[model samples]
Structure formats: C-alpha cells, structure tokens
Target: MLKISEDKRDTIIAKLKQDIDAANAYYEETIEPAVMERYAIFHADKDYYRKMFPRLSKRCEITSTDVQDTIESTMPVLMKTFFGSTDVVTIQGADGTDEDSDRAEKMQELINYELQQNKFFMKFYRWAKDALITNLGIIKVDWDREYKEVQKTITMDAEAYAQYRPQAEAMGIKVNAAETNPAGGINVTYTAQELAKNRPRVMNLMASEFRFSLDATRLEDADFVAHRKIVSIDYLRMQGESGMYQNVEEVAQKAVAPHYTTLDTQNNEYIDEQPNRTDTGRQKVELYECYVNLNMSDDPDGRLTPMIVTVSNGVILRCEENTYERNPFFVLSPRVEPHHIWPETGFTDLIAQVQHSKTAIIRQMIYNIAQGNDSKMAIDTAALVDINDVLNNAQFIRVKGNVSEALQPLPAAQLQSWTFNMLEYLDTVKENRTGITKYNQGLDSNSLNKTATGISIITQQSNQRLELIARIFAETGLTELFRFLIKLNQLFINEELVIRLTNGPMKIDPSDLDGSFDLIVNAGMGAGAKQTNLQNLQMVRELSTQLAEVGLSGPQQWYNLAKRIIEEVGFKNVDDFLIDPSQMAAQMPQQGEQETAGEDSKTTIRSAITDAPWQVQMQFWQKLGFDVTPQMFTEQVAQKVLSSAADAQAKADASRGDVMHDRLQQANLARPRGGGRMAGTTSNAGAQAGGSTGALEPASQYNGTMAGNAAGSTTAGVSSY
Candidate 1:
C-alpha cells in the first residue's frame, strides 16, 4: 500500500475533481438531454399537443404509445433469448486437458451459483432495458463481505446457560430478555448480528449515476470511471468503524446535501426537494466512488497506481490501491458507433420520429371526425325567437323569419382517407426501424400473405435483427461479467463451495478452479433458428441410430446425442430423462458379453424344461401361460434341438473342409502327379476278382473315402487297397 501525506492527497483530489467536472459537463450537455427525451417518450401516457385547438371543438390530445410498445414487446423476447436455460454461459477448457476441462466445468457451476444467489435475472433485465432505452447500460461486479442481522430466542436451563454463556458472548449476542419458568427452564431472547457472508456481487447501476471520461472510445481505454451515489453519514461511520475507510468521521460531520441531476429528476416520479435540517447522521451526502490511476508527488516511484478513491463534499473518505486486477464495471449496448463508446441510437430512439408523425396524423383524424359528426350552424340572432333554445340544441327550434334562410348548416371538413394511409405508412417505417412488427408480437391476423414460406421468411428476417442484438450482448458484457467473476473466485475464495446442481450436489474447491478458460454464452438465436437447430439435432440422431445398428456407435455416443437433443429442446437436466453412460457403465455388461449371456440363459431354460419329469414339464408350461400337453411341448423342443444341432455340425464340417483345402494347396498336393496314376495297380483279371485299387477309390466304388476324409485322414486320394 502506498501511503499519502495530507498535501499529496489534496493535490490528487483536486485533479480528480477537475476530471469529474469535465466528465459531468459532457454528460449533462450531450448524453443526458438525449436520455431525457427518450425517457419521456417511453413513459408517455398523458395527453400532449404542440398547439391549442379552436374553441368549442374537440380538443382531445393524443400521444402515440409506439415507444412503449416497442420496448415492452421486445424485452420479453430478449429475456427469453438470453435466459432460456440454466447454462446462461458455459466454459471451455484451456489447453484441452482433462483436468482443465473438469476445472472449467466446476468453475462454471460456481459462477452460475453465485449469479443465481445474487438475483442476476433481475439485474440483467434492468441492464438490458436501460441499454434499449438509453443506448448504454452498465453493471458493477465486485467481491465483498456483508453482515446480516439475525435474531434468535433460545430456551435453556441454568446448566445449559452456563455452558452457552461464553459462546453467546463471542457471537456478540445482545440479550433482549431472560425469563424463568416454574419448570426450571429459562427462555433466552437475543439478537446475533453474525450472518457474515462473502461472495461476488452484481449490481445494476442506473445510467444517471454512472460517469466516465469523455474522450475515450471504450471503458477499458477510459482514464476514469465513477459511480456517483448518495450515502447516509451513518453508513460512512459504520464503514469507518469496520476499518474499511479512513477519515470518514470528518467527512460525515461536514456531509453535503444531495444534488439531484436533471436525469435523476426525470427518473424519480415523486421526489422530495427538501434538505435534512436535523438528524445530521441520517443526512444524505453525495459520494463519488471513482476508479482512476493517480500519480502522487510523494516520490517513492513516480509511476501511476490504480486507486479507488471515495470523495464526498470535497473530502477524501477513502483512498487505496485497487486490488482487483481490472475495473469492475461492465457495459452493454445493442448497437455501437464506429468512433464513440455511446451507441448511436437505441431501438426507441430510431422510432421516436415515427411515433411523433403517427400521433400527429391520428390527432388530426380524430379532430376532423368530431367536427364532421357535430357540425356548427349559422344562425341569425335578430330573427331568432329563442336563441337559448338554439344554443341548447333543443329538438324543436322556433324561427320567425324564413327557416331555410335563417338557420343554415355550416359544412365541416371531412377527414381525408390519405391521412389513414399516412398513419399506416408511418407504422411500416417504425417496423422497419426497430425490426418489431405485428408478426413478431403474435398479431399476424391481418397479414395479406399467410403462406408458410412467406411467414417463415418474415419470421427469419425479423429475428435476424434480434439475434444480432443478443449476440452483441452475449459477446460483450455477459462474457466480461463471468470473467470478472472467475477472477474474484480465484482471488477471494479459499474453501470449497458446495452447490446443488441438477444432477446432484457438487463441491467446487478453489484449487480445482485454477486455470485459464474460455466462456461461451448460450443465447438462443430465435424461433426460426431454434427450429432449424432442432431439425439438425434430429437428423444427427437418425444418423447415430443407423451407425449404432452397424456397431459403429455405442452407449456413450447415444447418451451424448440424447443429452444434446434434450438441451436443444430447452431442457437443462438430461438426467431426468436418460441415464448417464458413465454411471450405467459400472452396472452394465459389455456388448458381446450381454449377447452371449442372453443366448446361454435361453438354452439353460430350455434344457431344464427338457430334463424335467412329465408332470413337472406340464406344470412348468402351464405356469408359463402355454396351453399344451407335455408330449407336444417335448416334440417341439426336440425338433428345435435337432435343427440347432444339425446347423452346428454343418458349420463345423464346412470350416474343416476350408482348412484342409488351404493346407493341401500349401503342400502342393492338391493335383495328381505322375500321369494321374495310382501307386498300386493291377490287371483287368485281378480287378474283376476283387478291387485292387492303386489309391483310395471314390465313395461310389464301394470304399469309405468320404468317411475317411471326414475323419481328417490323408488316404482319400492315395488309399490302401
């Protein structure tokens, strides 16, 4: 820690104050006015008009609600696109090692758990809405330890109290009461402010309270970033007492009044404009938590150090070097300009002019219709018998002069049909600007072209713009937020964080999460894209099934396919539908073993049935729900067994023949030699008496040549006579 003297602190504070002034000046002059304009339009519900209407006419004022319509209708879609699943973001392992993969997974789980605990959904909702409306949204992420007060009432006897007294004192328990009962039991009522929790926090900061350097194009490149807020004097005192701040008592004594900016006034519908005269401790002071690089003149090393400075009423409440490696603020924008950090125009901003044009056209149309429905009459007061009756619109009007000449109906202008055409044209313009149409909002009843192809085209085109916005948000702020979270866990977390996941309870140790990882945000593209993805996944499943039939795929592959399909269908917990291959692997047999076991079991049952007595076999078949006699069953089984045995014998004989042929070829004894003659021969007379064969004769010549060959003898071709 770099210590600063009083003079050096004053000099640094002055320089920061100058920077703050310049930043605020630019914000008020440029960004704030535009924000105020959009804010009014988005929340516009009252009647508004640029000029007064004529007397005794319909002065009905109308304000177009297209701004609100565009924002509210688009918000739900963006929310669903980002938060449709539990894995809002996923982690990819660095270096592709198994340990890194495991670490990445555990880190992701821990980050997601922290997000859920901090109510990240609401924070994201607010942040996205701000960006859509104001062209910029910011969130602050930090690590902090917070203490929440807890109250408990314990009933203990005298002996138990003696045992618990020291523990209660250590816990800083404030006793409210101690009552003794007749049953020799005492009830102890005390409040223990000891629920100290340490975790990462995500806070959605209002645009009005955030400021940054004006000359920078991005937050990372900015020289200073500050969150201007109002805190009570007592809050500062408490922080000081906790040793988190210094010189806070002096600042609290001179606490300044809260200064509400123009944007703040617009955001707050009903704000009190009074200063606190009494209760100085409860008075609110303007506090600017500025993160900047300060180079003090104290002269150890003149280089700049990243510092977190807390300023209120020209006094430094706290100043220290920033321990978190990076800045804590993350900004999100749907659209960006080439040369500036602030977005060019938000969704509402682009359609603001269209809203104004439609409001004007609709207002005129209403006015013209009113005049046409109730036209004014030209009456002569001098010839009128009762002017009061004519003025009161009485059914009967008495005129002394010629009725036709005395009372004449004035022609009021009828509304032009082109005005309605102009209104419709403006609606089209609004749709084109914001990519929000009736089709996207589920109001496609009036569409002229209702063909499936046309509808799909429209849906895809509309969703492309939304998908782009989602991609921007996911890639920019969301990724940075999770990265910051990982860094926080690495820096502050020491013990294991036990989180109950969808599969089961998992313990993530800090040491297990030490690595570099890549983040992937799981943002749904759109309905059209999702449908396409689902089709693709289904096709993959078909291919996988085919491969499995041919023994190319296994249980693990099937499990992965099934898990992916479930996730694509918007279900996060695949365990509810399918068992994991890893867990099932422990209890299941190999594929070949399973098949062999199945066949053996069947054969065993059949043999047991065959060997049983007649009565037992009959009873067994009866118990199996087969209505058959023992003889019939036995005959069927005998035939099956015979067929099986014959097939096995034929296969064995064929295999042996192949092996013998190969051996004969290798030995060059397949063909007859020496003129194809046998070694032993005799004359015709000797041959007639008996059979004097040179070699083994054929089976048809009354010799057992085939049986000898079947017995693996080599006397088939040259047999003994």
Candidate 2:
C-alpha cells in the first residue's frame, strides 16, 4: 500500500475542485443568453398568429360576396349574429354572455368550431368588402333599411353585374346585389383548401390597407414659430468714446494706415510737414541703361512733379555741383564679362574610356570571352574570361577563332613585361592589401590584390597558348594535324574502326559493323553485369537502324555489332567474358588440400608431490595445502567461499551477459528473464563431458547459499531500528 503526504493530497484535491468550479461558471454565464433568445423568437411567432387571425377572417368574408347578392347582404347579419357586432368583434355564438367567458363556454366552443371551418374565407370576404368600398367606390350591403329598399327597387342588370363582379371581388366588395335578387337567397360555399388558397390574397390586402391623413399642418401648428430672439453678441465693437470702442479703434488704427494728414492749430505748427522735394519724393527709375529722377514733393498738392533724367549705354553720369564735392551716387551700366572657362579638360575622354572598359568587361563576363588590346583592357578581359570560365565551361566561350587570330594585334612583348610587373606589384601590395597592421587602410595597395589572380593568369596563359597553336594551324593550313594525332591515339588503343556515312553511296559490311557495335556494348555491359544487356542491345540496334536511315553510319555499325553479340553468345556468357577479362585469358589448375603435420614436441614438468594421490576435484584450493581434508572445509567456510565465488561470478556475469539482454533491461524495467537459449558448445569433448556431468548443480543453489551468507552478514550489521 502506498501512503501519500497530507500536504500533497490536499493540494491535489484543491486544484481538482478549482477546475470543476470554473467549468460550472462558464456554462451558466455564457450559455444562458442563447437559450433565452431562442425562446423569445418562438413566443413572438405564436403572438403573430394570434393577432393576425381575425384580420384574415374579415378579408375572407368580403371575397364570398362575388357569387351571391344574398351573401353580400347576409354577411353583415351573419357576422352580427354568429360572430359579434362590436367594432372589434369578439367572435361568438348566440349566447348573450361574453363568448370567451367560462359561463358561455358552450357558445365559445361553438364559435371556435365555426372559426376553424370558415375563418379564412370570412376574413377574405371582409377584406374584399373593405377594398371595394375604398378603391372601386362600390357600396357594401346596406344594413339600414333605406339603402336595402333602394337596392331592391332598382332593376338588376345581369351583364353589368357579371363584368364588375370580379373587379368588385378583387377590390374586396360585392356589386351583385342589384342583379341577383332572386326569390331564393344567393348561395355561397367553399372548402378549407379553396379558402386557404384565397387566404394569402386576403391577408395581403389587409396587410396593405392603411389610413392616411394630412398631419403636416397639425405638426406645424404644434411647434411652428414666426420669430426668434437671438442672444448672440457682436464680434466687432463700434469705435465710440467707450474704452471697449477705443481699444477697437486703436486696433483698427494699427491695422490700417492713415491716408490724410492734419495740422496742429494751437502752436501754429505745420502738423503735416511738406516733405523735402528732393529727399522725400525723389524717384530714380532705371530703364535699361537710363535713370530718371522725379521729385513729387516739389508739387505740394501732388500735381505734375519735375523730373531729372540721365541716360548712358555703358558710362556713369555724375552730376557735380558747384561745390566741387565727389558724389558716389552715379548710374553706371554693368560691364558684361566673358564666359568662364573650365580649368580642367579631357576628363570626359578618360571617363568615357573607363566606362567603355567596364562595359566591355561586364559584356565579356556574360559572353565568356576576352576582347581589346590595352593593358587595363587586356587585364579586364582576362579577368572577365576567368570569372566566366569559373562559372561556366570553356566551350561556351564566344571566341571561336584560333589563338593566333585572337592574339594578332596585341603588344605581346609589352604585355608580358606588364604581366610580370603586375605580379611583382601584387606581391608587394599583398601585405598592404590584407592590411599593413591587420587593419586594411590603403586603397591603391588593396586594389592590386584579388582572389581571382590565379584564374586570371590561367585564362591569360590559355589564350596565349591557344593563339600560338592557332598561328601554327593558320600558317600551315594543316587541317588533318589534330585528326592525325587522334587517329594515332585510336590505333595505339587498338580501336581501328572508322565508320563513316557520306552523301555519295557507300557499302558497309554487316559483320564489320557488328564487331564495332559489340565492342561498345560489351564495354558498358562489362561494368553493369546486373543490368539486362539484351534490352540495351536491342535498343542500340533499333537506334542504329534509325541512324542508318538518317545516314549516321558510324553509330549504326557500333549498334549492329552489339546486336550480333547479344543474339549469338547470349547475355550471360558475353557479360561474363566482357566483365572478367582473366576468364578469357587463361584457365588455372584447381588447388588440392595439403595435409597439416601435427607437432610431436611436448613439454613435461615434474610433480611437486608425486607420491600423493592427485585431487583434481580440489584443484581450486591446490595452493592452500595437499594435506587439507574435505571435512575440514565447514559449511560456513564452504558457503563463504561459494558466496565470494558467486559474488565475483555475479559481478563478472553482469559484465558478460548478452548485450541484447542489457539493452532490453535498460529500455524496460519489467524485462522477462530466462527467455533466451544458451549457445551450443562446438567442441565434441566438451559436449560429451557436459553430457556425462549429469547437468551441473543448479545456479539457484549457489545463489541461495550466497544470499544466505549475505543475510547473515546483514544481520551482523549495525541496525537503525
């Protein structure tokens, strides 16, 4: 049984209760409103049915009057007698008590039964009557005797009555009374299904029936007014003597300048002084190179003012008075200066060249070729070619011309010198490039170093070598030179066949072509023996046939030989022979087994106690003494030895157990034991000896004895309880 601490148990209980409470609270607060809303919608539907049923019954009654005049006259009487005569009729039977009251329960029951039977038709009838009276200006049946006598005295017109009957019905009223006043009363009857069909139309009419009046005048009389007193104050104050007005006047005075001047009469001072003619109103107007000075103050009343003028194209006019004073004020035309010249020139050419070089380099990078002959130009071209070669293949390079044509105009000697100098320059600049003090700061030194230097050198060398080779080719026009070398290589490799197809007719021997075909097919089949060589052979044969049709005889001959090999030798022998070349070389003799001579030499040692009977059983304690007796080894000593041996064996066995057992035990705590069989002994002598031993002592006995010893030792240990 397991016992838990009170604190832990209490904590678990508290947490469980907290979760339960939270669940309960969530259900109550969030779920209740949705349930209430659904209930409200259901009740609203029931209310609509209860309130609309009477209006539906009134509309139906008016529709029934179309077929019979008596129906039109009797409808009112029937409503008064069967339903009720009240404005808002409480439908009832003939009982004098209120039809809904319990005292008139039978009458209420009768009314309800009648309502179920004819309520829809009755409502439609009522709606038709009201519609006819309102829209067609047709009269409903007069309940008063005066209207009934007049209707009875008028001669009934059948055609007029028939034509207007439907219109009258559509308008929810009856016009059939004057035409159908037969001695027997007009008859009208309908089933529930028929009434239901018409019920919607009746209900729609009732729904649309409305009363309107001129209420706008009444609304106006209730709230309209002719005059209203505004309580707004003036934002701008008049400039009177008051302080508020004075403040406004001061503000206005500051806002606008005075246009007139006044004189001070008390001191006889000219309040508005006439300004000096030359100083106050002097105007020097410069019209191009001319200056016109007008003194407006000379005419005190501002009439025509005298003006002084001077004109000069490029000279200054100085008016020197009789006083002999130098006047600085003189009109002088500014001299035009020649256009300024830029200090430096030819930068544009240098810029354009640099741009052209950069553009060329970029274009070469994309096209995978070197172009141009200048030093920087050649360097850029080489760099670009190197970059492109690193990114793509040499075959993609655009320059197809031989090396000599490619290098024709280059200054080879000068470029070689410059390349060596550039190498030296790179070596010298490397330290500066990487950084003189591990902090790179020199731009010019860094510019000379690049990771692509090796590629650049290789590209330059390749171009030069190609150019040299092209020069040789161009000068000698030796078209067969490369082909001759290839042919020699092929001959040395023992591949002599040359299959060619020409526009002219040529005959090919099938056997010769099949042999070449076999060579190629066998080469591939040799490496992949597991593949179906026959399928590959068949495919090659078909492709070769197709190629032959297209005049590609070389490939056809190769494939044909492959097909012959596949058909003749079969895939097994052909694949084996191709794959293992030694199989085709020579057959070696099978080796026979050689007898191993046993060693006759042996080592012998003298017995320590020859005369004493040998005790092989007691060999474990042989080092103790030869005189030791079996009985001298007591159970305790035996048990102790067994325990020690068992303990040591257990420790050793733990290390020696099956690795799988250790893994299973490590992975699972409940691993079952004794589930695997021990390995069988391989030695015949050991097997026979083990059989003769009558199954060795059970391991349980040794374990029990060891456990007993362990128990005894445990008993002697210091006890805490």
lDDT of each: 0.74, 0.27
lDDT of 2: 0.27
Count backbone overlaps in model 2.
32
| True-structure RMSD, every candidate | 12.7, 54.5
Q: Please, what are the lDDT tens digits per residue for candidate 1 over residues 413-432?
A: 87778887888899898888
For every model shown, the clashing-pair count is: 2, 32
Looking at model 1, the pairs that clash are: 680-694, 696-719
Cα distance off (Å), candidate 2, residue 571: 38
- Model 1: residues >4 Å from true position, as ranges? 1-3, 45-58, 86-88, 147-195, 269-272, 296-301, 446-449, 522-524, 549-552, 586-721
- Writing each residue's lDDT as its tens digit, candidate 2 over 574-674 gives 33233333432333222211111111110011122211233532352344333233432322233334335544655665776777546544543332211
The numbered model that scores best in lDDT is 1
The C-alpha TM-scores of every prediction are: 0.75, 0.10
Report the alpha-carbon TM-score of model 2 versus the true structure.
0.10
